[model samples]
Target chain A: MRTLLFLLQKEFLQIFRDKNLLRQILMAPIIQLMILPWAANYEVKNISLAIVDHDHSTYSQKLESKIFSSGYFKLADYCASFNDGYKLIEGDKADIVMEIPANFEKNLVRENKQKIFLAVNAINGVKALVGTGYLGNILNDYNGELRLQWVQPSKISPIPSIEITSMNWFNPGLNYKIFMVPGILVFLVTMLGSMMCALNIVREKEIGTIEQINVTPIKKHHFILGKLIPFWVIGIFVFTIGLTISRFVYGIIPVGSIGVLYVFLSIYMLAVLGLGLLISTYSDTQQQAMSLSFFFIMIFNLLSGLYTSVDSMPGWAQIITDLNPLRYFIEVMRMVVLKGSGFHDIQHQLIFVIIFAIVFNGWAILNYRKTT
Target chain B: MVAVQLNNLSKKYDKGKIVAVDSISFSVDKGELFGLIGPDGAGKTSIFRMLTTLLLPDGGSAVVDGYDAVKDYKAIRGRVGYMPGKFSLYQDLTVEENLNFFATVFGTTIRENYELVKDIYVQIEPFKTRRAGKLSGGMKQKLALCCALIHKPSVLFLDEPTTGVDAVSRKEFWEMLKRLKQQGITILVSTPYMDEATICDRIALIQSGKILSIDTPDAIVRSYEGSLFAIKSEGMYKLLNDLRSYENTLSCFAFGEYHHIAFRDKMKNYSEELLKYLENKGHKEVEMMPVIPTIEDCFIKLLKN
Candidate 1:
């Protein structure tokens, strides 16, 4: 235990002395909490729209007013012909265009059946689909009002409706920052911890100091542990700062107990540091270590669902994420912060993190060398 | 008592394609400074690594401090200190922090063992707070040595410890090793520097994964049997070629300001004959005389044999 503490002290001293390492640990979480929330939004507003009204009637004017009042679309331009509307879209000034038929009101009055044309940019296929649906719903409401005015109220029977009261469980507002800050913190910690430690060992090999250590009476496990503890502490320290930023800046308060989060984070940090040690053992050169670490971080971040919901991914992708510890960490963070989940709710994830820490750390110790 | 013993030790890298350390046997007695002198890729480092328990030999049984290097690696680790060819101390840590860290890892305190490394440690002790990466080459070398010696091991393995160090530091380092030797510790040091070979109590000249000769430095130089001469003229290159073409010259190679020539037999009045021949061959200010061979000359002769 004395040896372990000594090693731990050395690691801490090494970590605190390097300013670049400190910066990397703190930078990611700060940006995620302060800036990311403002940029990521699911509800699209202020959409540019163009209208081609050949009829030039009161009905077309009223339809435009309704579209503008919904606040989803802004009137970019008005065109007398379909070509002018196409030009507006081609010029990138409009996202959607609506064209009313010639004599639109006369046709509606003389013959109850009339048609209007709607065109949307399909380059962003998902956005286009949602925008078209929103516009269709608004027009349907307008049609229903016209039907009520024209038909007898007693003759039209009321249609049954099912109301959906969606309570976004963890984050009521579905703030992307609240969802992302914890995961980004995971990424930064893993990248910094693994890269720094990997380089630390390999750098010794390159610089000839590894010989000095190898010649010593130091045990292999002690050497590896001494290297890992400092980075692990740094990882947790950065995580705490990220949590503080999430609460103060983004107003994201964790629903789960802070103590429970720290316990889980502590285990997760070990798993990350273990991974770093494993990389260092396999690599003899700093360049090889850095490149290999970059590869792992890229794959881990992508598969961990740092940017998207894992539930939305395919079943196969979800299974792959099961092996990724960061995925479990993100899930636990969201459940604890957003849903106020207790130990029972996050017990499985916590266990997985513990197992991961043990396996990775064990592998590192097994591969590390006391000499050469 | 033997500090290190190896019987039929062999290590091959890349699935038997590259034989780094062939089947060889040697042992280092307690309190002796043994040197493994070889050029790069001569398997010196591989042997050092195997004895230090960093690598497992394919076919060998070795004991380090009475512990089997393979079966009892932890015990070997606890008894031996290894300084690899590369400078590998924690560059981010201060000199004192690195020293303390290694001491702590070995379950010892710097104060407890300060007396052992005090000579080398004190030189860099003023820079205890300075980061190791910023230290000069010589200072880093000293710091590395201090870290390695903090635990006072029964045996020490230094793999080319002075490979890139300055001449002055290299000299000072060997002197420190001599002091450590006085403490009755076994030391196994490897170096390509021929001059360093003279400092070891016993030296093994290795090449291409095989030991060519093992003896004292003076003995190896003494066994160089050919009559050698150092020849110089206005055109040293022309002089070398001209000497090689001579009827009695067995071998001619350039060495610094003179061309070292070895003749087939000892002939009385050979210098006068050689100088007269060189002058007639259009050479200016020709000078030739018999001289003693250095370790480099002996190594070249061994390679030829």
Candidate 2:
């Protein structure tokens, strides 16, 4: 215990002395937490649209106003010819072009049906898909209103109408930031904790300090613990900072107990810091450790269900997430913060994380060679 | 009793394609000052590392202070003090912190063994507030030695501690090591410089992962197989060329102000004939005579053998 205390003291002293590392741990991550969620939103909006109208009738004008009023698109320009609309798209003035046929209103009123053609820039595939889906919803509402107007007020309904309503529980407003902030917080903590511990030992190796350390009587387990405890404390401190920012800046207070979040975080950091130490043990230099850590972080970011629903992914991707440590924390964060879930609700995930902590840290401790 | 004993210890790199330390065996007596002298890549550091329990030998065994290196590593680690070839102290930490850390790890305090390191530590004490990395090369060497001795271990291993130190600091470091020897610490120091070999009680001359000779410095010098002669000429540039032309000249090498030469067979009147030889090669004002061999001479002779 005395040996570990001295080791910890030395480590903490070095950490506080380095201005760059101190800023990275305390200041940079907090700033990232405040700003990154604003950009991470996936809600498509402010799509510039151009319209080519060959028909100047009430029905066509009403449909045009509906698309603009839906808040998904903004009118860039109105063109009399397809050539003019094509020019607007090519000139970067519009994201999509809509064309109405000459007899669009006449056919809609007489034949009871008319199709409007659309051309969209598909360079950014997600924006194009969501914009088209919003357009489809607006048209559906217009058709329903037209059918209701044609039906006589006093006439008996020919068929029984089934009015279906969707009440989105938990998140009624569908604010993407509320869904994203907690997940982003978990990501930052895991990344900072792992990367710090990963580079710690490798930096010692590069600077020749590990030779001085290895020749001492310090036990391997004590050394590993001393290295991990400081970063573990930093991880919790960062998480608290992120939570306070979420409450004041983003108004995303956890519906469940904050204590429960910290409880899970304390254990989760063990797995993260262990994984970093494991990378360090396998590498002979800091550059190698950083490269390997970047590789694993990229994989974790993609498959952790932070941005997208994991169930929506392919079977192979879902299988890969089973091995990912980040996936469980993200799941628990969303459940407890947004869903007001308790420990009973996330017991399985907690158990899995406990297993991960033991395996990852145990593997790291074993891989570190004292006699190479 | 022996403080350290090795039996055919060996280590190889790149899967035995490169033998870093060949099967070499030697021992240092308790409280004896032993020096391992060799050039770079001569396996000096490799042998020190293995004996200090920082590296495992591929074959053979070593015991330090009544403990096997492989099995009793934990016990051995606490009882041995090692100063590596490179500056390994924390660059961000002050000198005092480095000493305190090492002392604490060994379950002792600097206060407990103040006498052992006081002579060397006092030299660096004025710079105790300075970061070890920021100090001069000589100051860093003294701080490293101080930290190594802070625990008052029975055995000490220093690997090329004076490689980059200036001449004055190198002399002071050797003088400090002699003082440490008087306190009954078994010191095994390695150096690439041949001149440092003379100060040790016994020395091992090694090269290319093998030991060339192991004995007292005088004994090693006396074992030189042939007589050596030092010659000088005003045409020193042409002197080396002219001396190799002599039929009886066995070896010729330029040493500082003169060229040391050896004859294949002992013969009289050769120096006289050599004078005429240099004069014919546009040489003038030549001086030639016999001189005693230094450690460098013995090393080169063993290398040639």
Over 4 Å off, model 1:
A152-211, A303-306, A363-372, B266-273
lDDT (10s digit) by residue, model 2, range B39-58: 99999999989998989999
Using Cα atoms, each model's DockQ against the true complex is: 0.57, 0.87
> Per-prediction TM-score, chain A only?
0.89, 0.96
Instruction: Return the clash pairs for model 2, or none.
Output: none
The residue-by-residue lDDT of candidate 1 on A140-189, one tens digit each, is 77877777688765654675444456788666677667777766666766
- Candidate 2 regions exceeding 4 Å error are A90-92, A158-163, B266-269
- Return the TM-score for each candidate structure: 0.91, 0.97
lDDT of 1 by residue, B1-305 (tens): 98889898998999999999888788889999999998999999999888887778999789999999988887887778778777778888888888888887787889999999999988998899998889999898888778777888989889898988999999999999999999998999999998999999988899988888888889999999867888788898888899989998877898989989887775544677888888899999887788999887888778877
| Model 2 residue A44 distance off true place after TM-score fit, in angstroms | 0.6
